[model samples]
Target: MKKLIMSKTLIFLFVFSFINVFIKFFGGSNTLIGVTVVTAMLMFLERDLTIEPIKNTFKLLGINVFLGVLSFLAVQNIGLGVVANFTALFVVGYLFTYDLKRPMYIAFGLQYLFMVGSPVSANEFPVRLLSLAFGALCIMIPQFLVNKNKLEKSSKKIFISTSEDILTKIRNIKENKNIEEINLKIENNINSLKKMLYDNRKDEFYLNDSAIDILNMGLSLERISLILDNYYDKKMNNNASDLNNKNQEICLDIMESEIKKLKLYIEKEELIEYDINLDEIEDINLCEFYIVLNNIHDYFDEYKKRKNTKSEKLYTGNLQIPSNFKISNIHMRGLSKESIRFSYAIKVALAGAISGFIMDYFNLSEGRWIMFTIFSVIQPYSENCIIKSKKRIQGTLVGGTMIFILFSIIKDPSARGIIIVLAGYLGSYTTDYRDSMIFNTMSAIGSAAMIGSVSILFINRILFVLLGIAIGLVVNKFILPYDIKKGYKYLVDMYERVNLEMIEEINLCIKSKHNNYKMKNLLLVPGLIEDRMSLMGINDKEQKHFIKEQKHLTSSIYNLYVNIATNKIKDNDFNEMLKESNCISECEEVKDVIIDSIKNTEDIGTKVACKNLLQILNSLNNKEQKITV
Candidate 1:
């Protein structure tokens, strides 16, 4: 939290506030209101969805500007305006979902919806469009610059924090806390680390060897944590008396020392070396503990050596972080009915269109609120959509009522600005939908109040919000409804198909020179599965185990394929050379092949690839069962 306050989010937020204040000081508070509200909405979109905010900001603004013009023209004719709203919402929704893997506007697509909401008035159109551009620039430019150096910052934070968490949980077990609960929290953190690393797989091309070392470091920590969790689960529950009086103390001491060393590394980038002689511990109960500490020591020592030996990709000519947005592949993966991505787009388009038609025909004041609600409330799945809709109503009722009272008491504009800022921030910091919406409603309504009657705006905003959520819910349930279980199965089928194709491609690439195409589903499918599993919230032990294992297995196969292809070991005679290694035998597992190859291979690159491949495949073979909740 301390680190958060001093960094990018804070810095850009300051810039955003300053720019909005400047706009407000010059009688653009209406524009200021628009700017602030839209920026808040865009915050969810860009921050959650895209890594390249600076680039994405430009791309999105260009689309918004074009559509803003079209919306202005369409609004001149009421009939055309309804159609335009539907078409704009539908097209943007569908095109963005074209890439199934999110930041698929998972949280908000309000920025685009806001663009097409303007009426036929020429005056309002430019203000809305210009405010959006100004609002986005104020935030995204600083965000891009501040985050430019933070490419590996999140991964490193996760790595260091989760490592500390594991050590802390180990200590907590000694405190006689609920061992199961401690272990579950540790597992969730571990999953967070994996999700962050995997979600950014494509961006990894920009990561240097050192940055990747941080990611690998996190994975290693997860492995060590898993070992501890499994060991403790059995030992703490079954051999409680035996452990408490025996190796637990010794192991705890070792873990405490490692925790200190881990902190030093996070602070100074210093590596650790375990001073303990594991041979002397001699305690049967703590054997795994000693082994893990030894592995951590080895990892740091190797990390130190590689830090010196490997060229930093950041400085290397081979590093090719694209300066422009890469065109995402636009091919449809399946029928609209089967895909969650398409279902979401279709539901959003229909809801927005139907609601827009109703609002326009009636010439409803703040009619866009209904469209916005529909867009925001209608999630990919129905259950979540239902909850979000309820929260949207609950938040608006509670927050709108409170803000109305406060704004009535204080006629001071500056006071309202203060309320706006505080409410906006409170919303951002909140995690729960209802809780954040309380603050978000306060902020949003407060912003709208700057230009209109608080009473009229409040009442209409409340009415439109309620109306919108209703339309959204109806559309989501009836219009191409999505099933979480079915979605998981679709992704499972995709994973099977994509992995086979990937392996085949690896085989083909090695056999031929045609290695140019690799399926994007290789990464996307597993990620989608992860997202679905998270949404489904599966609690059954066996089901979780199978899903986790499936993910690991696919990841392992992908890793092996990547290693072989990356090393360009197409012509390398690891198979034949393996027969000469005295330890080599016929393949019982994939690791056997890598083991044999690494044994005989003298080429540094092939040996490295083989060794890394060995580590990856070991994940599948590891006796320690990884824990998740």
Candidate 2:
């Protein structure tokens, strides 16, 4: 509750600060309009409100200001509007090379082109661009400060709580004599640790090489927890009839006491470190530990099996690419030069057309400025287009509405100043909430207020904005429909890519002396398998067949790897087993026989042969079975 209140307060403060800055620097009635539009755009794009956004916004603002000044000077002899628009477009293209930061750069570029590039007088462009740049800086600085402060607070709490939890869990494991209870507690703790690791690892600042190491450690702990749980459960079941033994009860009491001590240590808010000595547990039953160690060893062996299989998949590199570039391509797919060029061309054409129409309708005289906005801001097809479209529409409607309302309310020139101050407050709140609708509405109201105060007094301005939204929605839905089939294909392709990569990794593991590589590859198998299974619901028959074959091959290889790793058999021993069992040979032979048998119109001959091979492979022990490849 306190955190929520604090967050809201910071938002309001930022909005208030932005409005004040805008009025002080720009003073035009439309200053609020610009703020609202930019704010709405920010909300639409930034879902998580991470620190990266605040930093990126400021960096973009600085770049825009520098470029705007330069362009203004260049166009002093020519026309300021033309130079500003050109500069904005060029900067947008250059800065947008960093994928996530593209939106802000585009937003600034458009703001400059539309708001400043108009009234193409050579004298007015520099002042307008400077005002625009200053307005952006006002909003960006406060946003950055607020976000950075929030991140710092959140990080401190997360780490402290996580560390305490880990220590408490460790102590519980030390105390419990029932073993089953201890194991359960340990498993729970490990799960908690894994979740924390996942959260931290996802955070941009936390994504480092150490993050992967932490994840692996978390997994190892989880494995240990599981082993301990199983061992205790088995022992407790066998000794259930002898529950009244005093010595057993005493040992249990001691374990419970130790767990309490560990909890106390954790709660003390001091780091506790200790070296674990397994040999010191000579007095207590050693059977449980032995069982746990044995299981851990076995788990590692099984992991290697999965790893080897994955490496093989990665080496093959047989993943299929989508046929349709525009509809089917994903961001993960490496873009070809042709595709990039095509995107650039489409963007330029679309922007030119859209801007031309808007200018012709509004009779704003600076129609070319609209082209700058469209070209600079529009994302490529590879980005998540559906989300972007929704955001864009929402921001425009909301900003437009706000501008209209503010203009109507602030009819008197004297009250306009106060209303502008109020608009700033509203902008901050909208930006903080990161809602496209609210931000756009606020921006629209502000812009209308700035543009002739009497314009808002006219009641039909709201209708015009709504009409614009309707048109935009129609364009988005029908003109270039977002295809779900294409999205599914992209997912299928990603699965294939991951699978093929895993196969390659497996091949490397086979040749390498280090077994860790094999284990790492195996860990990736279940995730890929699960992904493929999920994609099956969304994919076509051909994709399903491809996934099925890949799954079968990987699963077979996984079993073979497991047999070799767990039993510690020689390569020759594995080869001999594979030869004797003839699993691979039989599978191939069955395929050939099935094909020939189908041609011959023979009844059950192919089926019988396939069934016989399956039965033999199923019955054969790992030691006796052999693989051909």
Candidate 3:
């Protein structure tokens, strides 16, 4: 109770109420009412205070204003208004995030619908715009003033925890214990670390480049995991000569010692010195490990250099708007159909039109809530809709019950307003929490009560919300229902295609005697695959297996690219060697198999391609060893 009272949410709520009071007492125009709604809507989007709240608040405010004006201009009829809403929703969904839960316009989109439904004359648009701008500044200025010291402290905590987890996973691999489980655990930790980096990037006020360094370090750790997997494979499958065995032991010890030193430096806040020698390794796999180990050392060296010049104050008050507004950039890749985005845009438009029609037919008051609930419950995938709808129904029932009890007991309007504001403040903090539906539903009920314009009939509100959910289900499932299985298959094919492209690029790099191509697509494949898998809700075991296999193939090819880049293959007949070894034919074979599988929707091609690709990798590794020797 005390923590809730002292939370930053309470600060926001106080500012909100204070602004409303100011506008009301000063006889602010009806436009100010628009400002109040816009400001309140923006407050719902304020999920993480760890980020640059002021910067994001301003950027989102700009987007809302843009959409609001567009929605206003395009409200000629229901058809055009739906078109405007669809365009706005699609653009926001694409540019803002691929994550459904964090749709950049989740609140703003609903507001646009409300504006469309309740038309304002063109003469008043600018005043409402200015009013919105003013309200956004008022809300964001206080957030900027409250500099939470915990931001930097939390960053350090994440750094230490991530570093510790990495070292422990390395230790586990060395012991050959719970190899699969440990690798999955490490991957999860790395993902958490990456998400932290993304979250911190939003905090432009306290932007730190060290997080970038940490992310690079994490990638190096993943590369190390690949090296370890290859090492284990070689050790298990092939018999090493006595000298090679002794050399492998020496290399492993040196690598482990360096990792321990890196952990100590990160945990103790000390400068690091590089102490690994990579010049004398006989094993090709160990040489690859040595290269990544040196990369990790370089990260620490760079960190030490920047540590001396680390800024004193984390908050700088410098903020830039996000610039992800390019429509051409949002290709329909991995979405199975080119028309998927179009389908979703139309679904939202139809839902809005249908919702408006229903409201008009029934003479419903507070119909905006019905439209809001429709979009809130409906998702691109039917499975997501079903899950969300169930939660929404459960939440609405409980919230409506609570509201009924509260209003039944409390008769004073002022007292009910204060309680509603307090409850809304508590709900604001839990918008993204696990039980967010319940909290948000309760908050909605409280808000409706405070407005007190319509009758406070809890049953009517619940029924209206249920009507919206039913409409959403019918729209999402029966009308152009999304094929999740097909989407998953498309992702599978895309991952393979990208991998093949990287290989072909590497082949060209060797043939052209240049390494200008950086294989950026190779780096993105794992993340893209992971994102799709998460949306589809694949198990950890499946995700790990796929990533492990894909990582192995990419790591092998990347090492070969690095070797060629470093002029290690210049004196050798690289093209002639590749021809004689049948590497190209093997690659072509894998490509053909993948194409067949994608065409037939069969896993046989994937299985064959993975096997052939691994063989090609092992063949390349042997060739590298012979050339280097």
Off by over 4 Å in 1: 1-54, 95-108, 115-130, 152-157, 166-207, 227-311, 314-327, 395-466, 488-532, 551-629
Top TM-score prediction, candidate number: 3
Model 2 stretches astray by more than 4 angstroms: 18-212, 215-352, 360-362, 365-439, 450-460, 463-467, 477-480, 513-629
Judge candidate 2 against the unseen true structure and give its global Cα lDDT, from 0 to 1: 0.41
Whole-model lDDT per candidate: 0.59, 0.41, 0.57
For model 2, the run of ten residues with the poorest summed lDDT: 311-320
lDDT of 1 at 450: 90
**Over the stretch 1-629, how does candidate 1's per-residue lDDT look in tens digits?**
87865664684486466656756743452343355444545453333224546556786567656666656665666778667766666666665663234534532256555545634356555676675556545545555454443435565566567767777777766665555565456556555544544434344334334544554455456455654544456545664676554566666666667766775776577665556553454443244344434444554556557656864444345434332222342324433577666787778877877887787789876787888788878877777799889888988899999899999998899999998987876666677889878897788789889988889888998889988887887787788888666766665565556555554544554454323223322433454455556657666776567555555455445444544545534325663443343221122255555666555555544554454344443443445753221
Superposition-based RMSD of candidate 3 using all C-alpha atoms, in angstroms: 9.0
In model 3, which range of ten residues has the least summed lDDT? Answer: 318-327
Flag clash pairs in model 3: 52-203
- Give me the runs in candidate 3 sitting further than 4 Å from their true place: 1-62, 73-87, 90-102, 117-123, 131-163, 174-176, 179-182, 189-217, 230-252, 264-284, 298-340, 360-363, 428-435, 450-456, 511-518, 568-629
Of 1 and 2, which scores higher on TM-score? 1
Estimated TM-score for each candidate = 0.67, 0.47, 0.71
